[model samples]
Target: MSNSKLFILDDDRKTRDLLLAFLTYQGYDTTIVDNDVGFFDAPSPPPRTLITDLPTLLARMPNILKTGADNDLVVIAYDKAESARILPQDERWLFMPKPLNLDELESMVMRAQEYHALSSRNPDPPADEYPHFLCSTIIGKSRQMLHLFEMIEKVAESSATVLIQGESGTGKELAARAIHQLSGRSNRNFVPINCAAIPEDLLESELFGHVKGSFTGAYANRAGRFEIADKGTLFLDEIGDMKANLQVKLLRVLQTKEFEPVGSTRSQKVDVRIIAATNKNLEEQVANRDFREDLYYRLSVIPITMPPLRERREDIPLLISHFLGQFNRDKRRLVKGFSRESLEILCNYSWPGNVRELENLVERMVTIKESGFITPDDLPEKYLPTPSLAPSAPAGVSLPEPTGIEELPAAGICLNSAVDAFESRLIQLALARTGGNKKEAAALLNLKRTTLIEKLKKKNLQAS
Candidate 1:
């Protein structure tokens, strides 16, 4: 096997020398540099990882990153404090607190080397799509989501108004924001106003500007969501919840690009691209005379419907990882990720609340839920489903056990055995998905770290 090289940067000569000797003894081609500048200017060492102390390391990272190392390059930061501060934690970066446990350090260094070797042996991510749009915020690879992304790319350049329709908590707002970001108006503001959140009396004033003495509490002339979003995108959320009177005014503005303030006679005009979203059925509301027909047509110019979370079950694991990383930043919980069984439950559960529900569930698991691998029971009662829908006994029906293991009756699998098998399979899958990070797996499973470990033990499973 080709030798792996490691570099050390530190202010203290003694510490740098010690690490250099230790790494050399571990069968590595090691180099010691006295300052960050020297480290940056060092001759391009064949694909190597770097280890250093934190004090000056972080201060000079931007420059070091500029002298880009091959993807094989990893960074490890060390400190003596009990809670070593690790900032901007990149996947290639590892952190260890000192008085360093030599064994753990060795294991970490070896693991980094192994990972680099494995990655180098695999195909690289496509260069053209390296920085995909909203790829960092929204994670999914299902055909449905891919098509949605394609549609977003198609509409990003045009100045067309977009209407995102979906069930509540399905991330309609996120979709709207994504559209704006990918469009030409990205540099401008994305003003969002929830029609259902504000009172009917204040909804009109909120959408359109109010002159100084327009209404009872209108003391000073105020710009509404439209004015603030001028030359930008205005997101009208819960548009279906707007009263009939407000709908007329909104429709007028869409058609005429002008509207009078609540109590002002002079009309105002603003070049704002309207992107409305709603969980309610505007067509039904229109049929029932609760919503205006003209308004519906105008708003539906570029309708983009977001699939409910349950409909796109394939995206659950990705969403779980995304949310876990978000919450784990502050929790400092060692919980690696989710166990398989927990993720199965999350995916199978009918997420009536959609993406919003899933996010809330993950947050609860990180903050107040049980620890270890998140188990089925750690989830909220609502997430478990009714007895009829439970994986063990479907529709309150029970199956007979196999007699003397005759042919191992496939139709008559025992509930305990079935659940166990399901959990075992899930754990294996989660581990494969996250490359064996228990905390990340737990997040994907929406389970606490401790609970995931317990479930793994019970199921007699080990992460690869």
Candidate 2:
């Protein structure tokens, strides 16, 4: 592989060194020079690309922007109080934030390389599509999520009935709202009713309007969600839980765009868009004769399925940052963010509750934890004490274990380098013992499965 030449200017040696090490590991010919007024004076081979913080870049803007006009440049700026007051508006420039989100960095590097090859356009995102209106308030740019956004955008342009499916807490309601907000009827009201939340007896009246004395308790004229949602969208949540008899009535509305109010013979005309969501498998419900097949087809003119959180792990960090900012404002707290170790614990967890669960956890953590970064220690009990890297001997089997490092040169050793080497070796041994079954290997090593996978990547090893 051909390595890209990179130049970095940052007075902070620790940050510079970390970037240097990471870029070097990624096969980049990287060099760091003193970040001062005369930054362009670095020797023989001049930099073709540059990476620097906002303060340093602003102090040297004229020359740097001049140089950037001819070469690719990346600006890492801080947000909030110490933020770059005004972001650069040049297409040639790609702006990102720091102290650093490694995923964002990696994506930036890959896209920059593609840009240099003239095969890709700048990958810098717009100021924002802003916050998503989707359920659980979707936040991500992972391939899976990007595709979902595309699907939502396309479906929103029309009046097609929608059926959203996913596991509980997967944001089905959010998706429904997103579709409505993006549609032509955005200015109109969006009515949402939970099929499962309402009593079966009241659901029919709740959906289709009721005139006076429709049933035993219908004392006043009432507009149902469908009528209330006329000229807009009606969200039917937990739609799979809707009874078969009600499903027939729903199908009639879908077919004629009209329905009669209870206790009234006159049919009322309606122009409402339908967006239905459910956590249960509607197809299974149909097979079990619990749901009507004809109604299912009518309601599902367009189907959208949301993948669970575990499938889109890349979004974890972005979600982390987003939630931190979100709760900070809503709860009026000043919790900074997560410590690296705490972030690792979060990313490794299999979020069975999906984005909703993650959001709730962040809110809880920020609320209870004191002002400052959320560290491994500050994390809840279940997340603390990352799994051990060393495996224990089986109950009946005994094996000789390494005692300690015996050899040391006259010069004192680097403890971190030594620990990394030891950890890498033990991980390999554990993997071999488990026949490359990562879950089993993680168990053998007493590590969380996600923790082990990350270690495997850092060690340049393949994981099962």
Candidate 3:
């Protein structure tokens, strides 16, 4: 059986005792708290779930939230709309009504247990390709991430060119750096250039050096990214945006490793590893004659796709806690963590901007909240759950209603498409709640691990 603890809080000694006994019988190690003091004063907070009664819940709410939010603790309270309102709209405090049904409670706890398990088993970062170069700074425990880490390790030993693909904000640059760091060129410099960010006129000089007076206003000789990255790695970001003319020159470098400076007749020979990234479909660009097929093939010796934040919602809480820890240290603020409602809003929204967007959100919350706690009200309007869609209870708090999902908009999407979307969401939530452990997701959803694997495949998701 999984190792998880549950805390039962009730003013009535009888209710607390009853829960402790029943929960213990069902294989959960239980802790009992009867008053406001125990709720806040536990020397080392219990490892498992916090299940509390309404009266004790309200008396020490703000403090409970502050403590739990600060520490990454999960709070479960008997849901009453009025009672839930007293707590902040953060994701840490979960609510379900009292007069408990053992089955439903077990289900909820089971899901929570899986999340804890998955989160605890994070993968190691890949080794650097160059001796001193390290891998990515991202923190994630999702199966997808762990698998990606493994792939980075396997590919780092080779000299094959790498193509990193993903939407903006998904950290393609970080992934490319990780590959280079883990590869054979860790001691060498990793030069990066954004093809789309520079004008066509300047881009040529950026990749290949220009001698003094190569063109108008070319005052002195300047080395390009290729010259600087000699025997190192050159990271070409937004490769799809390169002009057709430049694509031919770039292709030659990949094939011959030889190029002349803009004005110099001397052909400079340089050995460098190339890593390229793009958010656009290179194949389509090739078909349109925008991107050269030869260049595409040369750059795609190995390919890695970074999943978007929305596709991996299971990592939201971890991301939140990680960000909070960072802000806490940087600001020296006592602000604990997100209220249950805040987390729910975060997980539900489609993060069109990916992880970068989430980082901005956290920074914004830190700047705005005067007190230590990050309340739901601090969230941007786009992230707030609509009143119609919002649960009657606070965020992270679940109601006793039969469905955990919100009803779909009637007119927008067809039922099958809706199911696909919901299934994707549910899998993400299960993964997020389980800290990215598919085994735990399977257990929570009461499916075989293999079944979860199939669903992931059907949804175009990677299972670690």
Top candidate, metric TM-score: 2
TM-score of each: 0.55, 0.57, 0.56
Better of 1 and 2 by TM-score: 2
TM-score, predicted candidate 3 vs. hidden true structure: 0.56
lDDT of 1 by residue, 49-148 (tens): 7787757566556456656644557777786341144356565767766665554466457656654654555464443453332535655676667667
Which segments of candidate 2 are over 4 A away from where they belong? 1-136, 384-396, 399-464
Which lDDT tens digits does candidate 2 get at residues 1-464? 22445777777798889889998886787888775445455443432456667464655554656774435444444342343455445543455554475544544554444345432233434424533324346677777787787678667866767889999988888888888888999999899999999998888888887999878888899998888999999999999988878888888998788998877898888999999999888879877999886677667656789998877888888988988898999888999899888887777666667898989999999899747988887767654433434433323332223455465545556656666666776787676554356876798789999999999887787542
Overall lDDT per candidate, in order of appearance: 0.72, 0.72, 0.73
- Two-way lDDT contest, 1 vs 2, winner: 2
Deviation (Å) of 117 in candidate 3: 33
Among all windows of 10 consecutive residues in model 2, the one with the lowest summed lDDT is 392-401
- Output the better candidate (2/3) by lDDT: 3
Instruction: Name the lDDT value of residue 54 in candidate 1.
Output: 52
List pairs with backbone clashes in candidate 2.
134-174, 135-174, 135-175
Candidate 1 at residue 29, lDDT?
A: 80
lDDT (tens digit, per residue) of candidate 3 on 1-464: 44656777677787677778888887887877655555455566434567775664565667755665425456667765755777776545666565665544654565455435543555555543222212536656676766677667666766767889999999889888887787779888989999999999999998998999999989999999999999999999999999999999998887689998899999999999888999999979977988887677677756788988877888788888878778767876666889988888788766778888898888778766745677777777667643322223333433332356554444433555455555665666666554456877788788899999999887677533
